[model samples]
Target: MLDKTKRDWWRSVVVYQIYPKSFQDTTGSGTGDLRGIIQRLDYLAQLGIDLIWLSPVFASPQVDNGYDISDYRAIDPMFGSMEDMRELIAQGKKRGIGIMMDLVLNHSSDQHPWFLQASSSRDNPYHDYYVWRDGMPDSPPNDMQAAFGGSAWTWVPQVGQYYFHQFVPQQPDLNWENPALRREIYDMILWWMEQGVEGFRLDVIDQIAKEPDRYITSNGPRLHEFLRELSRETFQKGCLVTVGEAWGADLQRAKQYSAPDGSELSMVFQFEQMMLDQQPGKEKWDLVPLPFVKMKASFARWQQGLHGCGWNSLFLDNHDLPRIVSRWGDDGAYRVQSAKLLATMLHGMQGTPYIYQGEELGMTNVRLPIQDYQDVEIQNFYQKRLGDGYPQEEIMNSIYAKGRDNARTPMQWDDSPNAGFTVGTPWLKVNPNYTAINAQSQLADPDSVFHYYRKLIALRKQYPVFVEGDFALLEAEHPRLFVYRRAWQGEELLVVCNFGGEATPWQLTQEWEDAQVLLSNYPQHPGDLRPWEAKIFYRKNGAAGES
Candidate 1:
């Protein structure tokens, strides 16, 4: 059993993200529900994961796939009742696994009662529950564009005003400036914690601190104060872990939020690494090559800046991202090899590692035709492409390269029909590669990517260096390879990943004389890397003790 008394349980833990809608459907309703997750507790425990972060199960309109919550206190009807959630938590705890629920506090569906009341009239008690502004004559407030690609202001005919929506118009941003609204959110959070949840994964957490006037900028004077208040009241309870999704967070801001003094969150997810593929002049999802040098430099910067000052929630693929095997590595022909390489690189990093559902099984992104795209974000971009006078071929190419729905498909559990996710039709089409990339196929093969992840998690738990270690970027100038070192106490770990699709020669530095091959994506020592292969080496003496 994993030790629960560790000072930083998150550092050594491997969190598996589960998009409840796509995980499994026990009721044959073509949608995964909480009872389905309850049935899979043993499977998750067998996978050796420390925690499971379930994407929002709260009441939502399914507009943003549960990210736009309507009722924070009740479970969505489509995802089973609150009793099912309680049972899932109870069963998960018995398997030595914790549960983290997604907390979408930044915004709520327009269907939410609070939003309905806020938009009902100008003098309603909940009128200030959400951001509402009067249009100055005929122009909207500022030039802040909605992230979903339109005007951030949506005119509410009922209120004769416009409300702010960072995402879809159906979802309205909550007014965090309202003290009563803040208390209500906190009360809901505490209520869930009392119901046996171990932690929360705050969605779009950085968006909550939007400047009252500036709106888009961070570092608002009141933002830190609000976070500090939340930390003191909601997060300092010791058992409840809080991880924030803070996009565009720099190292200094990360430190202030995750300081050991417990000012804000326990850790925050940084999006700098994820934004590498975004080209200079592109608005749509454009696929650019993942430059190893830039990736190395970004990792080094965060490592140097946040060492002992803050914590990072390290991840590659999530419901919002394209599969790492497809985007970062060569997933076409070198799928298995590249998957293992990406796993080694992410798991060996000094942070709390998150493994998306089916990531351990080397699940590649689903290839969807332009007509099959269902994600609102993708649809918005496609409409933008049309409105901007872009050719249909260019829009199709962009969708093929970077659609969020590629990662939102049903989890591949086995070679059976519907990827063993449901006996009924899946909500989204399953990837055809599920026949070869299922968990059952990988579980039987000891050398599969799934087993590599198992080893990586085991190593993180076994060696303190993998968790609380200080990180040092090795000065290897090879463009095809990314290398780094982690040292803590007297142990050291050397991580080398070949980002290219060709065999590359890796020269071990003299300082790694005592290194032992701990793990590798390909068979180490005897076998050479076949493009995007990775290896982890453990040295007897730490980097500090060497030389």
Candidate 2:
């Protein structure tokens, strides 16, 4: 549980992450643009979001979907111009919403001026801006593997050296070891801050402070020093919300990155909870059922361990993940019920909640064949598996369950053609279920997933207990039930969710029998919970038979 006496505006904020390229397209370019996002400000405001975390639309070759930055100062032509971006900021502010940009500090595009000059000659001024090592043409300097699976080092023929890249070859890892490079990045951060941008979502920030010799990922020895330096240079200016995408961070590292001392960042997104269903010693493409005890223990530890020390980023789906309803809930026969249940579990937790675009409508993953997939990581994976003689169906099946493209599908705004996302053809296929699942269909239905999410967000804003309350986990071993309680001052909230596909007994103690319902997915429930049902109950101290 969090300390109710200590309050921060961001703790009660609801963030919505929008992938610009898939959000909407107003120019008939078959890709979403800034103008498209601006047109939807009211739509997002209606959903009760306080902040918008837009994915990168910076100048790039689109190798990793704008992540490989060619220029930090300009918007990609495909996404409209700088004027459009500024207009978005001004308009969002009018609605009481702030904007968070995706800041990719770990690397720059190989086509970037810095990388191009660095690759030109060993004595070039920008040569030290990126990581490079002397090695034989055919051999890498080390045995480190790239994130998408391969040697981390790529040969640069003109420079007669190998440069390190944690992702694809087009994305070259920057050398934070150099004082000049770090300053350049810091200056860029300040430049955006000066543009009325509220904050940044630091991309792969944990990998930025890698060991100079080993290329290891996650919390390096110099991580604290670097983060503190960033805070001193950028975050100290105001109440901007800076979050890091920390992939392999541990509990201790999580505490350090966003501690109350304000030396590092506002918070960080850790992948442990997202990786619960992944098999050990296997790649992310491999999937398994989530272990109840393991997940329960993890949730409890993080909640208690970081109680007053740091903050957590509460989420279930993002642009890089499969839809939550499809992955963690019953999406076949009970999609709506399960989606609402997942939302209840997410918003009831003690942390700032993040809603990925289209998640509010209970979007499910699209089962696309290999040919229909449109993601760089998925393309590379499928190519490798095909070359390795893996069956096509086996590869497609794995992709169907864990593909990043699942979350990248065009937004389903209405039942019209193309889901009303774009007047032109969409870059990727829209989910075929949009006809029945789009926002237009749900907006009119009071019991739709959209309304449920709206209610959850409104509750967080209205109740202090949902924001700064203490959390207590129950039924740690209950395979079907996710039971937890949040207490603040004299108010206690009991949140019970059924993650299974069948009815389960509600083991209420005597004190909890008279609990009044605050919210419920279904109209009513007697002694048992229906499949994927969720409910929250309110009780005050000494109010009833005391559970």
Candidate 3:
């Protein structure tokens, strides 16, 4: 067993994300709840996860699912009661898994008490809790667009003013400039921590400290100052682990946020790798080539930048992203090979690894018709394309290829009805491929993707080189392979992955000749790496003759 004392708990930890609505439905109400999660603790424990980052469970109107929080202190009834959440924390503790709730501090549902009160009258006490402004006569505030599409500003008839919502109109951005509002949010956070919750996964954290300019900029003076105050007063005590959902943060800014100084956050989920498919100067939903060189360069920059300065929350797929096996790997045929390869490439790097709910089973993206799309972002894009005179086939093709809803379908738990997620109807339709790709089938197969994940996670715990070692990318002149080295103390680990579909050959460097094979996706050594084969090697200190 690894020495728990020697490791920074967070550094060696693997977090599993639970999209609450689809995890399990205890009440048979066609929705997964907190009670369902509590009941499923043993299943998660068996998966070797150290932390559970539950997506937003706070009270919401479900406009953007649960990202729009109506009340920071209350659990949504669709999920469960506050008491149910407390019980979940209690049960999760017995299983040795920490729980992190999603903190949507950047905005709140317009139905929230604060927003409701703020909008009721101009003189309401909570008027300043949200950003309210007088319209500039005919022109609106710049050309700033809402992240979910359309204008960022919405007219509030009751207050006779316009309010800013960076996302949907129903989710109004909170005014962090208001000191009282900030205190209220922090107090809520403290209350949850006191109730046995471990920490928070801050949603759209970078947007919390936006400038009046209403554009994408990082580390604004006010933003840094507020974060410093938040850390000094709240997170610096070390009982809580905070990670930020910062989309555009570069390496320098990530270092500042995650530095040991305890200023902002423990780590931030940077989106550079996730944005690999996006084209320059075009809207984000557009599909482009997934260039291996660009992907390698992005990962290398982040790995080198945070070498010793700070840390990153390493992940490939999350609720907001398309399935990794489908987007980054060849489809179901080479799924197992690519899944293991991606795991080797990511888990061997230095950072905290987060596995999305269905990633271990090698789930592919759902193929849905245009009418099946429910995500606000996808809907907005479809509308925009139609308005712009784009052909219906082009619009449908984009949605099919890159829709956010592709990742939100119900979990595939079995080959039974509704993939065993629920006995009755599911909130969203289950993927039709669930019969062949369910977890029950994979769990019984030793060579399945699920087993590979178990091995990958176990290796991280078994070897310190994977969690705390210095990472160095090997110069493999081949375009189809990704190679890197992790070294610490007297231990060294080499990871090589074939990112292509056909067989590829690689020449071992002089430094790699002394290494012995430790693990591999293939059945034999140096055989043809049939599309996405991964191999790990442990280096011997000296020549065998000397020993």
Candidate 1 global lDDT: 0.83
Ranking by TM-score: 2, 1, 3
- Give candidate 3's total backbone clashes: 0
User: Pairs clashing in candidate 3?
Assistant: none
Superposed model 1: Cα runs more than 4 Å off: 3-7, 136-138, 215-219, 526-530, 542-547
User: Could you give candidate 3's per-residue lDDT for residues 181-257 as a string of tens digits?
Assistant: 99998778778878878778988888887664656434556877788888776766555678998886888889988
Candidate achieving higher TM-score, 2 or 3: 2
lDDT at position 342, candidate 2: 94
Model 1 deviation from the true structure expressed as Cα RMSD, one decimal place = 2.1
- Stretch of 10 with least lDDT, candidate 1: 211-220
* lDDT (0 to 1) per candidate: 0.83, 0.88, 0.83
TM-score to true structure, per model? 0.96, 0.96, 0.95
The number of the candidate with the highest lDDT is 2
Residues 110-229 of candidate 2 have per-residue lDDT tens digits of 999999899999999899999889999998788988888788889999989999899999999998889899888888888998998877899999988776466566677787898899
Task: Please provide, for model 1 over 360-445, each residue's C-alpha lDDT reduced to its tens digit, 9 standing for 90 to 100.
Answer: 88888776776677799988898887998988888877766678888888888898999889999888888999888898888899
Models ranked on lDDT: 2, 1, 3
Among all windows of 10 consecutive residues in model 3, the one with the lowest summed lDDT is 1-10
Best by TM-score: 2
